[model samples]
Target: MAGVWRQELSSLQAGTQNSILIGIIIHSGNPKIFEPTNPRYGFGGERAVWSFTFRDSPDDFINVTVWGSTEYINSCFKSFQVGSVVEIINSKVLSRRPDDSRDMFVPTVTSPLQITVNEGNALIQFHDSEGRAHYQPLLKMPTKTMDSLRSLNYVLQNIEELRDQFIDLLVVVTFIGEVRDIISRDGRSFKCRTFEVADASTEKTISLQLWDNEWIRLSELWEPRKTVLFLADARVGYDNFKKKTIVSIARKTLITENPSVQQALDMRLAIRNRPELSPSDPYSLPSPKNITNVMTVQQITQKLNAGSTGTDERVQFFAILYASITELNLDSKDANLLLTKCALCKRMVQKDRDSCMNLDCPSGNGSREPYNLVTFNVKLNLKDDTGYLVGCRLIGKAAEQIFGCTATEFQTMKAEQRMELKWKFLLSKFDVRMQVLGPTASITRAIYNILHMSRFETAEDISFDDIIDPMRNH
Candidate 1:
């Protein structure tokens, strides 16, 4: 626990992390010594602590007073050599002489009780700008196992087939197991361990379950002496009881080594600084109650501002990086991988993929090919102001078909041409946000879309073959 004087004395100190300092040393030649005590430091009138600081270094070097019981010092204990380090806890600097009328020029230490001697410097290690305490990112990763998890998200999130096949994308996995957790056909409880993953794209805690075969091979390369988790891929699904999904990873997800810290840092920076992102206020993270389908972007923006900017940095602090689960929805690797413009090559390519689709792309493999494309729909909406916010929904070629664009036309497009295509799609969404069509048409679609009640858009009154799902976003 911090002492009661911690806060008050800290205000007089130069920084937020440490307390005030004082010294007792004096220069050999210049007898004049003065250190004025600010009124806030407890001395209301003329009082000061005198000491000759080692000013030769140009970097801050203090001359603090040697503090101890009176029995510890001599009659002229006031004089001491510079650079003599000493410890003084729960002490304050003040004017040495209050009653003296003349020689108002000189100042000296009032009372200092040295706690210890031969003291070295002390550094404050905590970053408390937010309500929570934070440390520098320099701490070596706590685990020794090297797992490879790159930020392929900027490129991977744009994966059309992978996105369509999986309900959610899970990236970055870690676990404590050193051996495989194998479950055989005979229902034997052999261990074939799996890596656990959590991310923002879905609220689900996903994992990559290695089969006995992959686990065996992985065990060979994985040094059993120390525990290390390698990042890998997995297919996710709920268990028989449907409590939570376990990822079936042996099939598709690769088993790789651990990612380096530089990779993580780069991935984090990429996601944080992604172009066309909403700069959410770090102080204002929303609660579950605050999230609603009916909530406008403006309202969300307002709620975010009103949210707690944590004290001691426990709450909100880093603008792009919120430590919360939702804030960490996307993986760092995902951010680095998803922004890729080359759908075919999967290279760290340009920002505009449509340009590649149109021109003779070095990495192009035609638009209709399985790994050839990735597209997103930009939903533009107006809140209090006109068209102030945009939401992103990923889509595929089928969505373009719904928009009446042919494959040939979409493939041969320049950057502006593709943006124009997206812009047109957003314009249509703008009409929807504005409720462009009058009451009847709007009611017809809204009734069908929300309640799944209308016959015009759905086969509500007609066929039993109607998809029971609310909507297929892609």
Candidate 2:
């Protein structure tokens, strides 16, 4: 007989028996059916694995994976959804070993422990009203203000920035184009929808995409310029064919109409003042128009020296990719040095014994699991015939694009590979555009944020200079 075992999720260990755990479900995956290879099992059977990120405290959650027979999945867990409290009794803990795989984007649990429900011995039950009442205070802790939500972090990021990294986002939309159904090469048809969104932090309009059922539902409510949409938990990733960033919704994403939050209302006002719709076509998002005031490297340096340019001004310019810097060659005194960021909040976090040390962070407070994400800052030197700018930073998506891989992938490369990559970028030339964040007492203190980077292409149809110069004239 299994001995009595009851412990908090934080104390769960392998080999525990007659265990009991209770927490709310955060994410669940579809069940799969498979045939057992052993001759003893003659027929095919089904099993499903679901992930539960539960917490007794409202501030944080501990992720638990539960896998069991189809009968248990359908009868006991099928009704479970995010926010549902569940009680799991009589399970075994199986510790997962560290994986050294290259795909960092794939979700990996840092917690070594996982619980398996023993078929006949385990029992699973949903909490009734009285049971749920105990958790109500924790659950009813005031919903975070929109400003405090994680989605606000990426709202200001431009399309180019969004494309450079794999990130989940929250965005507010001011305009939505009509929906269209498109056929794929496999002769299958799917619905595609495109929309335009803008935020107070940026003047440029961002294009957004939704598909199939999401499009069908959103299309009915979506209005051109009239409807304001608050989209949460959408993913931002690159589109290979289009060579740009795209935002798509996932199952857990929240879509709401007429966003009344202060931040959304402020962004809507910003959009109304400078209303411009990006090309509605899903495949086409044009590059930023070249302004006549495009400054040269000399002009930018002189302006920085004089402290004449407004900090808020987003200036466009052209410069050559003159050099690249590695961590080995970095000056010890550089203020904008690289540091690791929290995956959820993008805030600098200190690593504790195993997990991150930001007690206020949900990941930090919820579970003892180590952080799966860490990022480094990359710097490039820009120059022209007139002057040069040293240590120009390329962060997040820009840095990822420059390396031609994700930050996680770059971090895993060998020392020699990383050194070789530095030289490769040093050989390339490009037109660089950036926004000036004003100068401090020293020229080195001035900050420039990369807005876009394009290769120096010289083709028969249209040369890079030909396309850029004409736009400048307009």
Q: Whole-model Cα lDDT per candidate?
A: 0.29, 0.51
Candidate 1: worst 10 consecutive residues by lDDT?
A: 446-455
The RMSD of every model to the true structure, in order and in angstroms, is 29.3, 19.1
lDDT of 2: 0.51
Best by lDDT: 2
Give per-residue lDDT, candidate 1, residue 126: 22
Query: What's the count of clashing pairs in each model shown?
Result: 55, 1
Runs in model 2 deviating more than 4 A are 1-5, 33-48, 69-77, 99-112, 118-121, 129-131, 134-164, 168-199, 203-236, 241-243, 248-474
Model 1: per-residue lDDT, tens digit, 302-402? 33344434332221111110010111111122333123334433333445444344334343434333233344222322222211332222223323434
